[model samples]
Target: MGTRQTAIRRGTNLPRMGDFNESVVLDAIRRVPGGLSRVELAESTGLSAQTVSNICRRLLDHGLALETGKKSFGSGKPRTLLRVNAEARFAVGVHLDPAVITYVVLDLLGNVVAHLRVPTPPVADPEQTLSGLSESIRQLIEESGVPADRLLGLGIAAPGPVDVAAGLVVDPPELEGWGRVPLRDYLAEETGLPVVMDKDVIAAAIAERWAGAAAHSGNFLFFYLGTGSGMGLVVEDTVLRGVSGNAGEVGGLGAACTTRGMVDEAIHLGVLSHDFTPIGPRDAERSLAELCRLAAEGNATAGDIIDRQAVRVGRGVCAAATLVDAELIVFGGPIWPHVADRFLRIVPALVEKSPFVKSLHPTRVTSTEVGDDVGAVGAACLVLDRTLSAQPQSLLLA
Candidate 1:
C-alpha cells in the first residue's frame, strides 16, 4: 500500500483540555482587565459557586490566576477577585528570515520579556545553523531569569512553500539547501522542548489577532514585506492555511499587474524591491535601509522605486481585498520599520483608486504597531494561542 496522505489540514493544534471547566473559567477571568470576582466569574461562566471556588483554587495554585483586592457590588461582603497571572509562564518565539534570525520571549499576557536579532546563517549548513540558533534560545531563557520549567514551548515561523505536514522547509525559493529539512523536529530535539512551526506570514496573522493591529478585526489581510513579499488572510476569525500550507502567496500578483513581460515568481524578492532598492545585496547592512536613506535625502530614483513598488503592492492588496472582502490590511515585516509610514500613506489611496475596490468602502491600510518584532512576536503567540486561548472546539467537547 502507498503511504497515507495527510498533507491536507488547517494547521491548527487540537490540544485536549485536561479540565474544560477550569479552562472556561480561566478564559472568562482573562478577558477582564481588572479581574473578576468569583461571583462574577460564576455568573458569567454559568458555573456553580462551589465549582467556581474549586476551579479558582486550582488556577491560583498553578500560578495561572492571581487573587487581587476584594470587590463588593452591593451591601454584600467583599469578594476576592481573580486575574490572569501575566508573569506566571513564558514562551519563546523565533522568526527565521534569510536576512536575519529574530527571537522574542513573551510573557503570559503577551508582553515582551526579552528580544534579540542576529545575523542569519545560510541554510546551506542547516545543522550548524540550527545548533547556533538553539544556543541563542538557551541564552534568552537563562538571561531572562525565567525558570526553564515554566516555559511553555518554542514556536517558530519560517518562510514558506513549506511542507506543513512534515514540519519541513521544502525548497522555499529565497533560502538555499532547505529542501525537506524537518525544522520542527530538529529544533524540538535540539532544545529538548516542544516545538510548533508554521509559515512566517501565518504566524504574523496569529500575532495580529492576539494583541496587534488586527486585535478585534474579524477579517483582514496581513501584507508581509520582508526579504520577499506575501500575504496572510484571516477570514471569520481563523487563519486560512490552504491545502499545501501556502494560502496567501501573492508575490506573483505584483508582477502580473505590470507589463514588463517579467515573470513574478513566489520565491523571488522582486515584488519587495526594485533595481534601485535591491534587498540584501550580500554586502549592504540591510536591504532597503540605504535606499530609504537616499529617498529621504531627496533622491528621485530611490523615491521613484519605492513609489512604483507601493503602487503595485497597493494594486495587489486591492485585488485581495476585493476577493476576500477584507475589512483591513496590515502591512508588516522586518523591512516595514524603515518604510512603514510611506506604505501606509501611499497604499490606501492607491487601493481606493481601483474602480472595483472604490465601489466597496475603502479598505483600512496601516503599519504593524508591533513593528520589526512582529514576526518573532507572532511566532511566540502561536504557542500561547494553541495552548491557552479558548477555542470553540472546547465548547463542543465540553
Candidate 2:
C-alpha cells in the first residue's frame, strides 16, 4: 500500500497561525514510510526548524505522531524519526449504491479495519432506508471496537447528481423516490459526527489515488462499473469536480454500460430467456452474472454480447483518456469483479492502439487494487483526506 505525496505547499512561519504549517509538516511526515526527523521535516516542508519542532511536539502530545526510532546522518547525534500514529484516529465511510449499501471504517492510513454490505432496502420509504443505514453504521462501528472519541467523522458516497453545497442527494436516476434528500445532514445528525458527501465515482477515484493502484498516478481516469457506470477524472493530482460537483457523468456512455441496459439487451437478443428480464436493480445484477457465466461457459451469443460491450467501454475510455491526457486508467466498482477478466483482455490493447495515447504518452490500463469495495473504502478516505491531509486551500483566510 503505497501513498503518493499530495501537491506541495510551503509552510509559513507567521506567529499565531501554525495550524496550516502544522498540517504541512504532518502531511510531509505521513507520505514517507520510514518516518522523518524534525530536520528532515523542516527541509522538505520549507518550514523553519523551530516551527517544525513546535509542530512535532504538538503532534506527539496529541498522540497523532510517534517517535519510531533514531536515524543518524554522518557523525552527528542520532535524530529521532517521527511516524504517523495510524490508529490514533479513524473515519467511517458509507457508499449507497442502487442495489447495495456498503459500510467501512478506515484508520488514518486509509486501511479498511472493518466493513459490511447489505442489499439496498427495497422499501420506497426514504426515511426507513435512512434509518436502516444509520443503524448499520452504528453496528459496524461498535463491532469494530473503535473508540467514539477518536472517530474523526463520516463520509457518504452516493449516486449523483448531488447538491454538494446544500448536502443533498438530488434526484439520481437509479435511486427512486429520493428527490433532494438531505442525506448528509441526516446522517450527521444521527451519528453525531461531521459528514461529507460526494458522487460514488469521484470517491472511488480518490480511494485509488490514496491507497490503491493509482497511488503513483497524478493523471488518471477511474471508470466505475456498478449498477450504473461512470468515470472519475484526476488531472495533475487533483480530483476534478466541476462547478456543480458533477463532472463524471458520461452521457450515453454511462447508459450503454449499465447492468440493466446490458441485461435488457441480452433478453431482447434472445440470448437470455424473457424470464431473465430484470424487475429491479438486484435482478439486473443477477441476470448480468448469468450472462457472464454463460460467456465463460462458451456460449457464443452470450460471449458476443459481452465482447461487444467491452468494445463500447474501451472506446469510451480511450476517448476520455485522450481528452484528459491521462497516463493511467483504472477500473473498479461493486460490479467490476464479475467482468474484470473479460474487460482486461480487451481494454488494454485498445488503449495501446489509440493513436493519441500512443503518440503523446504511454497509457496503462488495469483494475483497482482496492478490490470491489473501493467505493466504500473511498467514502472512508473522504473523511480521512479532509481531517488529516494538508490542503493548500486551508491557508486561505475566510
Candidate 3:
C-alpha cells in the first residue's frame, strides 16, 4: 500500500485503584497556586468533598503534596490548603533509535537528574534488542542509586510508526520484519514495569510543548529531521493523531522533483533507485544519513541530492502547514543541528518564494535546543504529563 495505516487496538486494562488519585489532586492544587480547598476541588472535578479530602490526605501523607497555607472565604471557616510537592516522584525516560538510545531520569518537577546514551543494536532482532534495553534500564537505575519503586515507570520513545495504545511497532519499514512487534509488552514483561510507547516525532513534540521552546505555542508543527524525516502536530497542547494514527508521515508525501518543473529530475539524477528498497520507513535512515554527510562534505553531486531533498521537505512542510494550520514549526531531528545555522538562513526564503506562501507566511521555522535527546526526553515528559496532570491516565499511562 502507498499509505501506511493501521487500526489502533486497545490492550487489556491493568487494575488501578490509586493509579492517579494523588496526581489528580496535586495537579488541581498546582493549577490554583494558592492551593485549592477540598470544596473547590470537589466543585471542579465533580468528585465528592469527602473523596477530595481523602485524596488530599493521601497526597500530604506521601509527601507528593502539602497544605502549605489555608484560605478563608466562607462563614464556617477556611479549609486546609493543598498544592503539588513538585519534588515527589520520579520517572525514567529512554529514547531508542537505530544509532543510539538516550536515557534520562527526570524528577517530578521535570528536571533532569541524569542523562546518558548507549549504542543501539546493529541488527534488528527483537529478543536481543529488548534484552539489551532491559539491561540498560537496570544499569541506569542501579548506577543512579535510585530506588526502583520511587520511579513511576518507563516511557520509551520508539522510532517509526507505533501502535501506541497496544505498544506495538506496526510495520516499521526501517527494521527488517519489525511489523506487529509487541514492543511495549516485551519491555514491560522483561522489566516488570509499565511501559508507554509513542512515535519518536510525536514524543519529541510532547517534550517540546511540555518544557521546550514550543511550550508557549498551542498550534505548532514539530519537524523531526532525524536520520529520516517526520512531523507532529500539537493543537492546543494535544497531539493530533489523524484517522489511522499516521498523520505526520511527511516522508511519504511523495517525492516530486520540485527543484525542476518535472518529477523525473530525481530519477535522472540517480539519487533515488527503484531497484533498491522503497523509500518507506525501512530505508529512510540509511539513505538520509548518507545524503547528509555528502552535503556536509561539499560534494557537488551530494549537495545536489540534498538540495532536492530539502526542496521536497520544504514543500511537504508547506502542505502540512496548510492542512493543519500550524502557527509555529520547530525543527528537532539529528540532521538539523549539523546544518541548522546554514539551513535556517535559506529555508524561509525558499518557503516564502513557494506558491503556497502568497497569503500566509509559511509557519515560523526554528531549531530546537532539545536536539538529539528530544525524543527520549519527550518520552519522559509523556509520563509526567500523564501521571501529574488533571487527567492522569488520559495521555501516558493510558
Ranking by TM-score: 2, 1, 3
- Candidate 1 lands at a TM-score of 0.81
Worst 10 residues of 2 by lDDT: 1-10
Winner on TM-score between 2 and 3 is 2
Q: How much RMSD separates candidate 2 from the native structure?
A: 2.4
lDDT of 3 by residue, 139-250 (tens): 8877776677788888888877777777888766555556688888888898887788888888888788666767556678888866556888977556877765566776
Candidate 2: the clashing residue pairs are none
lDDT of each: 0.75, 0.87, 0.67
**How well is each residue in 309-354 modelled by candidate 1, as lDDT tens digits?**
7778888888888888888899888767766666677888887777
Candidate 2 lDDT tens digits, 42-80: 777788998999899999999999999998899999999
- Per-model TM-score, in order, reads 0.81, 0.92, 0.70
Candidate number of the best lDDT: 2
RMSD of each: 8.0, 2.4, 8.9
Global fold similarity of model 3 (TM-score):
0.70
Error of 2 at 102 (Å): 0.8
**What lDDT does model 1 reach?**
0.75
Best prediction by TM-score: 2
